[model samples]
Target chain A: MLIDTLITGLVAGGTYALVAMGLTIQFGISRIMNLAHGDTIIAACFASFVLFSVFGLSPILALMIVVPVGYVLSDAVYRIIMRPLVARAPNAGALEVDSILVTFGLLFVIQGVLLVAFGGNYTGYAFLNTPVDLFGTIVAANRLLALLLALVFGITLIFVLSRTRWGMTLRAVSIAPENAPLVGIDINRAARTAFALGGALAATAGVVVSMYQTFTATIGVIFTMKALIVVILGGKGSLTGALIGGLLLGLVETFVAAYIDPGLTLAATYAIFLLLLILRPTGFFGQAG
Target chain B: MNTTVAFILAAAALAGLAIAPLFLNAYGIGLLVGMTGYVVLASAWAMFSGPTRYVSLATVAFFGIGAYTVAVLSETLPYPLVLLCACAIGLTVALIVGLSTLRLAGIYFVIFTFGLAELIRQLVTWYEVNVTGTLGRYIFLPFEGIHIYWQLLALAAATLLLSWWINRSRLGLALRAVGDDEVVAAHAGINVSRAKLMLFALSATIITLVGAIQAPRWVYVEPAIVFNPTISFLTLIMALLGGATRLWGPALGAIPLFLLFEWLSANFPNYFSIILGVFFIGIVFFLPQGVLAKIEGLRRPARKAPPENKERSGAA
Candidate 1:
């Protein structure tokens, strides 16, 4: 039971980390905490669902189409709306809050549009009907595959952030944009790229989530909140932080539920989040300000 | 005399509310009461968002607290005392929370408050599950229907007065400074942290008072309903719709928008949320200054060029 639970927790945490990675990069590079991130995820989820229910395509194949569309949509949003704001010279907090407003406005639109397009019904995939026995306990094959996909994406994200020149430039901009421009970095373009990358991650998470559980249009708000918690817990700007935080949260929530009541799972998760904020405001692996 | 005028105005509003039930149908009365609660909640929402510029999604927390306080308190005490207790409970919790997080700035504050709200929701849900036998609690009040209108009206009036006082007070000035520039506000001799903490507590108190009234009015209290983000969303819409940094913006925004919502919901039914959501987004992006400012501009379109002295003073 413990092994099964631990594996399940890890898988869940891995998926969360995948979602948090997008948030981490956007916040770190652009200093924009995009609240509409989850709405886009919800949009992607519905997109996958529509592809599945209408065209009878497999979830994996649907993801390929949804991911690119998500990236393009987010890139367009950044170019059309957020780019103008980021181009301006203003207080960091003001700019960040504007991002929140812009993203929140987008959230409202996406949610409304989705509800209009598809009734508020839960959508899910039924690919893995049989559970595979791992050692002594039974686990779903899809869960394992989802975790593998998440791990692959997470590793790729880390590689991009750490190894690429563009990634280094993003870090430079995040650390000091004033200096980045002096060093010949196009801060606007970098920020826009980060936004697109984050959008792709959101869509990827959405598609994976649709594969795992049933979801509806209203899930956007809750998902956004959950992702925010993960972002904060993971150390606002650190992908490593997001991974650790997500895993910790997943394990903690699962253990808490296992020991206590399942109904209070959210409460326990929130409590730990509060504790983390009070104790280490910057987060576990976060660099010091 | 000023106090008397304020009192008379409040009384007149209450009187109008009392008669609203006689003319309107039950559904209309229900909608009015819900909107009143929302206005109160939204104004309380402004106490933090307006001055701090931190759009907290935690209005639901104190709202649930207020709702549950009423549910739990009305079992033992009178409705008025329960209402008072609810506000006190809300105030105390807000104070503790504010003190803990007031030192954090910008997004940190937002996260802290948001986390705290989610925590409260969890506790409420846990309580409902273990103790209350469900995920929600229902409040039963002796007097039903329009009889509660006076109470709601009184609550709204008190909220209006509180907002007015806050706007005119030194604390309000300090909060505004904090919102605009914390470093400058601190350097300029305002105890920025204390000011934020006070405002947080004050905002929670106002929201809780509204929750107290709402609990009895709805005759039901649930984790979902009380912790509903609708309170925060509507408050945000209202504050933004009326311009945040003003006294009467929330009321101006909430009252009319809610009326509009009533109209839409009555007519469209199914597509109500979709339409409302779209409209909200459109307004936010296009008119960050809010609909009220646009209306005000149109109504008074600088009829005559202001005197040079008046213009200078206004600029100053």
Candidate 2:
């Protein structure tokens, strides 16, 4: 039973890691909180739903279409909303507050658009509707598939960040944009690219999440909060931190739900979040700013 | 813009609002009551977050607690006492939260407050489900629409007065100093953390009172309804839109936006949110300082002229 729960938790955590990675990129590079991050996820889910239900396309195939769309949409959002705000900001610190307001507005706008496009109703997709025995525990095949895909995407992202010149450029910009410009790195281009990548990752996570569980337009905010918990727990802009944080959060939540009253799960998650903030605000892998 | 003139105009407006219920119909009174509620919320939120530069998303948490307090205790206690209890609860919670989070700056502070609200909402939902066996509590009050309207008006006036007082006080100066640069404020012998905590508690108290006063009008109090994130977003937007930095900015932001919200929700319920979303985006993009500030700037453009530029131009 414990192993089964652990496996389930890990699978759930995989999707969280995907979403948190997107957030970390945006936050690390641009310093924008991107409250609308989960809305992009929701939009992707809706897109996948339409493709599957209307066109008889697989959700995986939908990803090929959705990812590019996500990239463009997020790029547009950055250019239209965030770029102007950043230009007007007096300093990096002020950008945080301004982005919060602007992204919050963006969240509402996206939600409203989704609501107009698709009413407030739960939508889900089932793939590989079979339970497979892993060792002695039973697990859903689709969940395993999601886990595998998340791992692939996560590894690819890590590779791109560590082994690619573009990744180095993004990292340099994130760490020291002022210095990056001194070194001839295009800060604006790096920021725009990060946002686009973040958007794509968000959409991929959304697709996996919709397959795993039901979703609705209203759930975006909750998902955003959860992703934030993962981001903060792992350490503010650390990819490895987000990955580890996501898994740990998943395990804790799963264990709490399994052993204690399920109702306390969210409360417990937030309690740990608060305690972490009080004790070590930098998170496990984060360097104190 | 003189303090004395502003005070007189504020007093005249308050008097007008107080007497409005007599001449207005039920719908008009309802609209005014809702508008006043937003005014109180936005202004109270501005009191702490405006000068301190702390962008708090926890207004809904305090508001929810107050609404729930009234919902649970109104049957057993007097309305006035229940309101006071709500204030006390809000203050206590804010004090605890502010002490822990006030040390963090920028996005950390913002996230902490936002997380605190979400945590409280979830906890309340859990309690309602496991202990209460019901989603919400309903209160039957003996007050009419006019009484509620008067109470709302009084709350609005009180919030406005408190905000005005804060803007004029030493605390406000300390808060502004903290907002401008916390280290500088600390170096200047101001107890920065204490000022933040006090302002947070005070803001929470006023917001709680507004929630308590407005609870009975709804008759039904649910965690989901009272603790709705929309309240936080709307209050913040209204305060920002009207000019969060100014004393009367929130009121200025609330009246028009609330009216538009009411009109759209009533007439085009489906498209209302879309319009609001677009409006918010427009405001953020075009007028980050808020509508009132924009108007004020337009009205007195010469006030913003750089002294150096003026002297240089004169010499040229």
The best candidate by lDDT is 2
Please provide, for model 1 over B81-199, each residue's C-alpha lDDT reduced to its tens digit, 9 standing for 90 to 100: 88888888898888867766677656776766655666787787777678867655567788665766667777778877887788789998888788767788889999988888888
DockQ of each: 0.35, 0.44
TM-score of chain B of each: 0.84, 0.92
- What is each predicted model's overall lDDT from 0 to 1? 0.77, 0.84
Candidate 2 yields a Cα-based lDDT of: 0.84
Off by over 4 Å in 1: A87-89, B1-28, B115-118, B134-136, B292-316
Candidate 2 lDDT, tens digit per residue, B1-316?
A: 6979988987897788789889989998888888988999999999988887788998999999998899989999987789889988999999888887787765666776776777887788888798878878998989777888788888888877877788789998988888777778889999988998999999999998888888888898888888888889889989989888887789889999898888888899977667876787787777767777677668888786332111111000
Interface RMSD of each: 7.0, 8.5
**A1-289: candidate 1 lDDT, tens digit per residue:** 7988898888888878888888888888877778888888888888887798889987799888999998898899888878765655255776676677667767767887888788788767686656988888888887877788888888888888889987899889878877999988998888888889899999998888777778898878767777788888878788888877877777877877787788777877777776876788777877766
Best by TM-score: 2
> Which lDDT tens digits does candidate 2 get at residues A1-289?
8998898888888988899999999999977888888888998888888898889888889889998889998898889888987777766667777788778877888888889888998887776769999989889988999888988998899888979988899999988888999989989888998988899999999888877788888788877888888888888889989888887888888888888877777787878888988999888999887
Instruction: Give model 1's docking category.
Output: acceptable
Candidate 1, residue B72: the lDDT equals 77
Candidate 1 CA-lDDT value: 0.77
Give the docking tier of candidate 2. Answer: acceptable
